[model samples]
Target: MIDSPKPTSLKAVMETLNAQEAAKPSSGLTSKEKRARTVARLVLVQALYQMELTGTGVETVIREFSDHRFEGDLEGEKLADADEAFFGEGARAIVKEQATIDRLITDRLAAGWRIERLDTTVRAILRSGAWELKFRPDVAVEVVINEYVEIARAFYGETEARFVNGALDGIAKDTRG
Candidate 1:
């Protein structure tokens, strides 16, 4: 059984990560490594959502997740073991680079469709996907787009998933082109 880490303010999570060393994913991952990465992306989106909703800092969120959330079960649902480093590094980068990321997303958004107008969950999903597309060259753009689409589907219907796909697709073409 995993012990729940005490919840710190989400702001602490961002601050903690801001001070931590940079984290990045490596290539030539094994199947387990790939699964872990997938889990990391899912968790990253959740963390981002948590941060936005609570105005939490990146570091506190990452610590909370690493200590409590990464144990393969969240709220009685079994989860794949997540890549802690990837989650931490990605979270840090996402928060730190959020302005630039938001710009990328805003640029790809259809005219008159501001990113802020999107659902908070959808915004978090797009932010995570955009980060990977722009920064994680080790990961393929197709994989990044598909993974986030599935993540969106987990939280929403096909409409949102397709929206995530289209938004990330545009970002990928711009970044990975």
Candidate 2:
């Protein structure tokens, strides 16, 4: 039997809770790889949000995830192994280019809406999804939107999922269309 790693601290609880599983049909990737990437995206959003709230740096957050959270199992459910490279790239690149990313998102938002007005979770999803659409040309735009929509739905509800879809779709259209 796989041994779930013991909880090291309250931080571990946050990490596990933040990265609850998401839903996405296969996007030409093997199941294992797909799950890993999904987990990576979820983790990146959570990590970025945490950094924003706590005023932590990317390197510190990445180190904390790599050394403490990713390897451990929470309760009976194991933390799915995520794509480390992708996680690092998403977390670092999004923050590194946040102004540009936000600009892209802001330009796409509906007339009355603003990024700052979004809930922290929604903003995190939008930023991470925007980063993938803008920079990760290796991933198809549809897949990018689908993955993030699923994550938003998982964390929130149908409305948030639709909001994410609209925002990311606009980004893809402006950038990739």
What's model 1's lDDT at 164? 93
**Candidate 2: how many backbone clashes?**
0
In angstroms, how far off is 44's CA in candidate 2? 0.7
Tens digits of per-residue lDDT, candidate 2, 121-142, equal 7898899999998898888887
lDDT of 1 by residue, 1-177 (tens): 222222223233323322321233344666566666766876888888888878779999988887777765544333446788998899999998999999999998888988889988788889999999999898877668767776676667578878899999999988988
TM-score of 1: 0.81
Weakest lDDT window of 10 consecutive positions for candidate 2: 1-10
State residue 139's C-alpha deviation in candidate 1, in Å. Answer: 0.4
> Cα lDDT for residue 34, model 1?
66
**Top candidate, metric lDDT:** 2
For residue 8, model 1's alpha carbon misses the true position, in angstroms, by: 28
Off by over 4 Å in 1: 1-27, 75-80
Scored by lDDT, model 1 comes in at 0.75
